[model samples]
Target: MYNKKSREQLLKEYQKETFLRKTVSFYKYCTIKNPQEYRDSLYQSFEQLNIFGRIYVANEGINAQISVPENTFELFLSTINQDPILQAIQLKFAVEDGLSFLKLKVIVKKEIVAYGIKSHEYDMNHTGKHLTPVEYNQSIQEKDSVIVDMRNYYESEVGRFQNAITPDAHFSKELLPMVANQLAGQEDKKIHLYCTGGIRCEKASAYLIQKGFKEVYQLGGGIIQYAQDQKKYGFKSQFIGKNFVFDDRMSERITEHVLAHCHQCGTKADSHKNCANQTCHLLFIQCENCAQNYQDCCSKSCQEFVCLPKEEQLKNREFENKRLTSLKLSTKFRPKLKGLQKNAV
Candidate 1:
């Protein structure tokens, strides 16, 4: 049996916990006869296990990235394994710990990865060959190998494999097409792809292959699993900088190489952050100094906006919405990192 507290109570317990927990992610692509029933059953089971993370269920499949207590990790694994649909699924474990998420969120969505592609566009049975870290490292050295990063610009900014071609698209919907177009001429080349975990590459590789790519390969478990395997295999990590994650942890350093600049100071830093202003949470990177100086706001305008009275802020947001409609300014703001004191260095 499992127990669950309210979201507020869960936050309180997290604050008081003394033991370190592990953040892990896994996903599987399978046809579901009834998504609603599947979603409800999964929610009931995972919640009981006391798991904390975000899960997206859809007709296409399931995608999840979560953090669970080390004590219940085995139970969590066993619970999922017992499921007929999820049994024998290969989970990609994270190499570093950042306490990625604070609470559990199970959501039913349209598509697990949300590529906006029709269901008939990709064949899940024909995904790229999964290569371990050693194989990925060796394959890239071949004369015709082309490595590509299949993540958002912000995610690749923090950490990515050396010489990996990063698509300039900002959102997931645009990423697939841009990557396909970029590698159009190199169809016969040995195309190697990777993402934070293996999910993005899993679909991207299959899509590319469908688009005529001949020798497509994906890093077995993305960088997370690659970093873990590096310990035992003693292979020099080709990835440089921190691996950006979606949860509260933000990013994890994978190597000594820092190839990114601080978004504020343009210095040698690769840390990613969301603007601290609740009203406008734009995702970007800022160094420690900039983080301290700006209090995590994306700009001075946001800094000033956050200090206004609640009513005044609401009025201003309404006004800005009308004014910015023609200009099409994004209202998204970066959320403040939890557990860390607001604006406290």
Candidate 2:
């Protein structure tokens, strides 16, 4: 049997199939003796059921985001549950699901969340308290409480909890130190944390506790679960705006609030788009009006470049790189935004 094919072929075949599918995401951090072996085993099992999506396995544990067909969803669950390590894991369903992923991929990594902190620095066994959405909502309302958004600035730019302290770091490596410094003097304050999924907060809350944070709590299952529970329990959602997602949908609307502005015109907008220029696929926010005006480019220069012939476009990239130096290009979207806060953890 042919077990592998190009992504184009796989997607084309998937399009022809009429079966309905559901996307389910879940993660767990525990010791895995042989990640490669486990990855291969899981991939084969999932392949038999025609599951598709990305999954990462590390020595620490497994983090999966997979789409299973409706007919095989129960069997998929039971198959994974048969493995003692992943038995009875809580699965978070996507608010909007279709063909969210094009293919199945099981990768092996060193860390599931990739916070770039030393594993010895924080122990997962001693992680922070996991709070339900209701408990998380009430804790943030307490006096002297600090809510820190664990995702990148772009992810939080579209949606985050009210009164949450969002770090300006662009990369995951800069997150821990930045957050630590931001909360430096507030060691005794009740620290509430959250992420797109709950993975990042797992390590973040643990690190905060090691830094002498007296109390630390994380939104159980992060925003995905919060949105689900809020609807199921009929509670008011304090998290406003869009939840930036990695899938094709870009974001999941948590509430009606649009808290971000279009990067080009500064119009009230929360939708994110990649510059139409394939080489300069810079991610930024653009309203429908600006998206039409700019031809979905991050800048007028990119707009022009994308319209050029393939050969000319490649030649222009060399000159464009010189014009947009590393520093200028990195902060192009926020030329006038205030400098990142300098606080000690």
Candidate 3:
């Protein structure tokens, strides 16, 4: 097993690495007979190769967003291909190096995308046509084509294709129904869909087709591969702004355009970050100035908790635990908005 270390130490070691690395993302939707066994075997193999990133395996499918040293990327691919379950999986390559993740974490979840729909809603056998970047861009020019962004609101806030219809869903569970409702009357239109790495849209396209959409298509490898193809073919990029990602490095700038504002300061910033307070890790965007002033906490409560002496903090945690046990109170943490307190305002 790979030895665990502090996040600070891990960050330092990552900065010290001399070689370049590639960030790759991919997902597969298929029934898994043995999730635990599959996860363990993949973890062991990836650890041996020093591969690092987050991976999710569940009954429905597997999703991965990882970075591999350039020299070892080919080996990594070959190793994954050797596994029968992942052999024919289509991997999406990133456009530029984003230094996406710092460590490898494999988690077992109930569902990979968390759509919360019944199994009968989608058939994996029938999915939308996978169009390359060139094909996708060309199709968008057609008079009847409708393009949609298949990510959440915060993700779309950073960057998206010009004129793409962005659904106002806050979570994956809300995304499908919202998209379906938004395009309800346009079932016969030629629809082009995309997401960060193409996995969500793959299943989404399948669902849409099942819902009676006539012409359904998706960016084969999503924005990441689309960017890569843009460089190779010297084609102008149709998408603008940053591609929000889930990692220590929250986003990759696809273009120089800054299309979003920082949640804290309203500055032209597209960066996204989670609160530094472990107990209140609400995802938000803050400019550098705000981050410095708040010490990366989301609210005053979190800031005060973090500032307490170690012993005091531990005592409070113990007290909180006792309260939960005695009162049978729920211990689940909910994200707090920054400006809720009058003092903060």
Candidate 4:
């Protein structure tokens, strides 16, 4: 029911495995009779298949981003498809992958995507219209339609649609309400919504409708599908730059455009990294040069602290982050990476 190995041991094991792994994400909003029972079974099934990733199971549905062994993909697929709740569901494969996860974690939560809205706020049964990637491209260009990015500010900071109404939201709980406020007088306008995997948009579009907004439409499978469509259909991507992912890889480049600048230095860069200093693990954009100069740390002070004796590090760990915060050290983005070849996409 749990991994017996330490984090270091797990990382080493993942690195040593020679098998190809496929990183993918999927979600569905469906009824579940018993969430705890389902969670237990799901964990057992994924564990047997040597799966590694995070998953959330609730009375509403399931959401997961997992890494599967390439050789056992079919087995994983067949096993998953057998569940009535998950059968015929669409899966979004990562555009690029590295060591996406080190351990498998299945949690039981109140909501899968965490919009923090009450039941009276949304009606999933009467949700927004679904638009294919090609259809989305055509519709978004219309003068009357408004494209809104239903994702966190940091996620959108790295990549987003050209003319999107990206809310300055730092958390999912605040995004929908902020978006509603932003579109206050535009209830009659055609509201277009999208998120990483289309999950967030599902609830958001519905909420907009409940708020008296008409003509709500969501990107069918979100950006993951859009990127695939662009590659296969040879259409210019409306969304540019890196798609920030919740994984070790941080992001996957969607185009050649470097939309973000390094937090430490102002050069164009899109790579995201947490400060290597355990006491000051602030997430920010760091260029390779700064990464080397600071030893993968956010500030020189923290870098120096990391080199102290083990007992010293422990003694200062509690106060280190507080001191850094008081001094306003390290760079922070607006409420908030990857390098890719131009011709690769």
The order of the candidates by TM-score, greatest first, is 4, 2, 1, 3
Summarize candidate 4's per-residue lDDT along 177-238 as a digit string, tens digits: 89999999998999999888888888888899999998999998889899989898999899
**RMSD after Cα superposition, model 2:** 4.6
Q: Each model's TM-score, in the order given?
A: 0.88, 0.89, 0.85, 0.93
* Residue 166 miss distance in model 3 (angstroms): 1.1
- Runs of candidate 1 exceeding 4 Å displacement: 1-10, 309-311, 320-345
Query: Which parts of model 3 have CA positions greater than 4 angstroms off?
Result: 1-3, 15-18, 315-345
Task: Report RMSD (Å) for each prediction in the order shown.
Answer: 4.8, 4.6, 5.6, 4.6
Instruction: Tell me the spans in candidate 2 whose CA falls farther than 4 Å from its real position.
Output: 1-11, 311-345
**N/CA/C clash count, model 4:** 0
lDDT of each: 0.77, 0.83, 0.79, 0.84
Q: Per-prediction count of colliding residue pairs?
A: 9, 3, 0, 0
Model 4 ranges with Cα > 4 A deviation:
324-345
lDDT of 3 at 130: 93
| Model 3: pairs clashing at backbone N, Cα or C within 3 Å | none
Clashing pairs in 2: 180-345, 181-344, 181-345
Q: After superposition, how far is residue 98 of candidate 3 from its true place, in Å?
A: 4.6
C-alpha positional error of residue 67 in candidate 2 after TM-score superposition, expressed in Å: 1.7
Q: Would you give me the overall lDDT of model 3? A: 0.79
